[model samples]
Target chain A: MTISWMDPHTTSKESRSCIDCHTDPKALGLGAGSLVKIKGSWRLVPATSKSRDRRLNIPRLDGFVDISGKPLVLTSRKDLRPFDAAELKRILDVGQCLICHKDFDDKVMKNWNSLSPPKPCKFFLKTR
Target chain B: MKKRTTYLLVALVTIGLDTDSTASYYLGAKIIMGGNNSVVECNLAKVEVAGSNPVSRSRQFIKTGSHCCPFFVQENFYMHPRRRLLTLAILFFSLAFHSLFPCTAVPPCQAAAVDSPSKVSTTASGQIDMCLSCHDERPDRAHGRKVLGCFSCHLGNPLTGSAKLAHKGMVLNPGELYIVSKTCGQEGCHTDQVKRVKKSLMATNRGIISTLRYYWNESKDHDADLTVEKLLKSDLDTPAIDYYRKLCGTCHLWLKKHTLPGFLAEKGGGCTTCHFYKPGVGKDGKKTNHPMITKHIPMKNCIRCHNRSGRIGIAYKGIYEAEGYGTPFEDGDVSEGQLSDGRYIKRLEPDIHFKKGLICIDCHNQKEIMGDGNEKAHFEEQLEITCTTCHDGRQRLEKIFEEDIKRPKYPLLTNLVKKNGNFFLKGKKDQKLHPLHRFLDTACRHPVHERLACQACHSKWVPQCYGCHVVSDKSKDQLDKLSNKQTPGRWEEFRSFMRYEVPSLGIKKDYKTRQDKVVIIVPG
Candidate 1:
């Protein structure tokens, strides 16, 4: 599934894109899927518009990612900059989604979906 | 009768009576007339005298007795003069006989005439010719007195006492003098010493064989036929061997012939004959400037160090026993009081100092003694004056540690400190740093270590470095260029520095090719 998010703050012609926070492991809620597991298994899920409406977890997921992965997404976060394929590959490779999600099995997916959301996301989801 | 008549006639002749007929007749007539007439005249005179006086007889007698028979008688006798003439003739004949037959008493002229033939010749040329007849054999008498000739010593003219000839202006006797002087007494020449040296360690057949073996070991071609032995024995013109023999022959002869105890000869008078400080290219392409002059130290003086009696412990085993100490003399064992002979003496602790099987040249070298100038003057100045020439003061004290301490291990790091800070470290603390770091710390201090590597400064101990780095292609090229570029007087320094210093350093710099490349992991 494809994921999208709105600019939290906008002032000039160049506004923040959804990929800025969601794609970067350094940003809040960016690495939430890496932390949660069911039946000792983990999976990465793309966020839908409905899921974005339900929760705004940022800080909790960021803590789950290793420090080395934090700077990867910051390289592509600026809006209106030229889209770099090599940079996109580097980000996807670090996220592990390109490899894990490409050949997703039903059983693995079912276990993945059953897991509880991380604290930052659950907090926002409960509040909503 | 005839015999009697002959005897009478001979008697008459002897008496000078005229035997010829005419003389007989005149004699007879004179005798007849004079006998009678003389007698009658004498009688008449007497009678006349007698008649004159009564005592005429007495008077006549008196007259006859007192006077000549008177003038008348004389006149009558004169008329009969034959008698006087006869008497005169008899006297003349007697005189003639005496004159005709001289007695033993004769004049000198008559005697000379009778004894010798009186014609004699006198000439200067004839006398000179007589002299030349005997003396002609010895012409150029002075020239003949040369040693080559018989007259070399036997000088002077045989004939003339006036003139003198000598073996003048000639210096040496040809046969005996030249041979003895050239072979025995000439200052630097020593053919007899050469003969003696042949029996020495350096010049013996065995020595040549060993040297050849050493050379063969160093060479790439290892074929037995091409070995040093074969090369020496094989009639090949090896300039290296020739050079070795020539240079080694000089001092080796002295060692063999002159010194007492004869240790050099026993060891090999040619100790340095084959074992010179030779410079050449090493396995690595570097120059090797071996200090050639250093190996030629007179072996007689080696006793100062190498003798059992020497103070420096220069003996084969002495140095090893003296290791780890400053000077052997510094310790109480080598006391000033005990050294009656004035040589430096010390108690040698074999266990602590001895490196059982070590050679002296392994540590000491001529370069250290002679310096880089390699001039005769410099060598003479430094030969036995300094301790560092034979001993590495730093290594002996264990100040720098490049190699394992063979004996008498001492703490060197404790002594070294940063001049800026007195902070010091010992053993492992100091050893833990990188090799380069330790090198910089020790070598970069105030003097900035003129010799960069441990081997460079301790060259006498580590002479192999010189062999490897002295004559490489690069250095040869540099030397060739330098030969052309350097000014005349200043060139020797450049040559020496290049030949000795550059090569020595090059060995350390080109450490990759060096055999001593074992990486030492300092214990942390």
Candidate 2:
């Protein structure tokens, strides 16, 4: 069965493939379940649980290999292929990349605008 | 020729007769002309003639002459008679003049008797023997034999009754008296008495002198210099030292010789010697016999007669004569027969009161415990021992509250009122009232609980209370028991009462506002 994405606050068009919106470069760093479609039903996951699930799916299999030299996996499933740089950028923009990892947020890392850097944690999570 | 010659001879004889008459008269006149010496000679010659026959001598001389010469010779002879008679009268007159007035030539008979050797020996023997009979009869009586005359020994007006011999017989000079009394009559008479007096506590009065000297040295030099002169001129004329010398010295010297226990001899009683009771009213309304009695009753060991609590029996309420008066009893117990109306009178116990043991020096001695085992000299050192020494009232109460009662948090209040007008209060109290008010209220409210007097709380700083209340080590326990009910709350109540009545009590600052500000701002 195919999943379609929809915005509940607005009457918007739906997509047949989940990758059309979920993998879109502009929607990558947006709300976690904002682009997901589940069997014609559209519901957003809880903010804290969505962020935690997104953290588990770190490697984009459609993109090049990460610094670990292992093949990048774009999907949460184990068997996904790597994608090229143009496709990766189209899938994850600079804004999206910056939001995905704490190190990429120049303003937060440099403490510019008096925003303190995120604190370290035993579990991999950002702390203001 | 014979008649003519006879006549001529008679004329010559007549002339001779006249010449003899003239010569006789001239000698008589010469005798008159002479001073008293010639008068004496004329009188002597007339005396000789008067002793011879006057008429016969005259006639014989006349007949022996010749005719005309006979008449002339007879006349010469007759004139001789008359001249002898005249000489005799003049001699008698001269003797009368000499008898009427005596010259310095001879002394009167009365005067002669005094100058006689027999009289001189008799007068000397009478006066000397009278003095010797009484004074020089014995060897000791003849103290200074070399100077034995009345005038020499006595040396006073003979008219006045105060001649030394008349008054005291023979007073040796001061220097001589000092030597003879000290040496000649040494151990035999008063030497031991003198020694005891010297060692007695009275003799140990050097402390007063030392105190006076210390004051003298510490005072301004000018003021100290005038002390002697002021003391001499003052009504108290005798200096402090002189009082000790006169009152204590002579008696101590006497005690040194006569009394046994030489150390205690000089300590013989003074003012309190005869006046045995303390100076006050006894139960009988009569003045107390001894004026120096103190509050150290238990220490005085007064329990022998009075109750163990030192309370006397009701029978002793009035002045009773000392024990053993009309009774034929011994040991202060009365005989039933001696009692009036067949009633048995209880006799006062013979306790060791002032007469037997208590002496002024025993209490008044300096307060410090001298390391040398001698009594301390300084007042500061001596007064350290107080009523609290023997009485454990406060300590016992505090202990009860702390250990038995289990009130460890109970407050302890120690208040000291100084003579200099300073009050020190240490404890917690409500902020609405002053510390003094709180103290007084606490003290007065529960008088039974805090039975202690104002003097008891204030005595540590103001020692003048001792003038009335005398406490010693032995009496401490009794005093504590008597004051056991005294508690801090009673003192607080007394303070509160004072504050309500007298609002200005204990507010000493110049301005009330200043005190308030200090109290509010200061942490303590």
- State the lDDT at B467 in candidate 2: 8
What tens digits encode model 1's per-residue C-alpha lDDT throughout B464-491?
A: 1001111222122111110112211111
Docking class of 1: incorrect
What TM-score does model 1 achieve against the real structure? 0.17
- List per-prediction Cα lDDT, in the order shown: 0.26, 0.25
TM-score of 2: 0.16
Error of 1 at A113 (Å): 55
DockQ of the candidate models in sequence? 0.00, 0.00
Task: List where candidate 2 sits over 4 angstroms from the true fold.
Answer: A1-128, B1-203, B211-239, B248-375, B392-524
The docking quality of candidate 1, as DockQ, is: 0.00
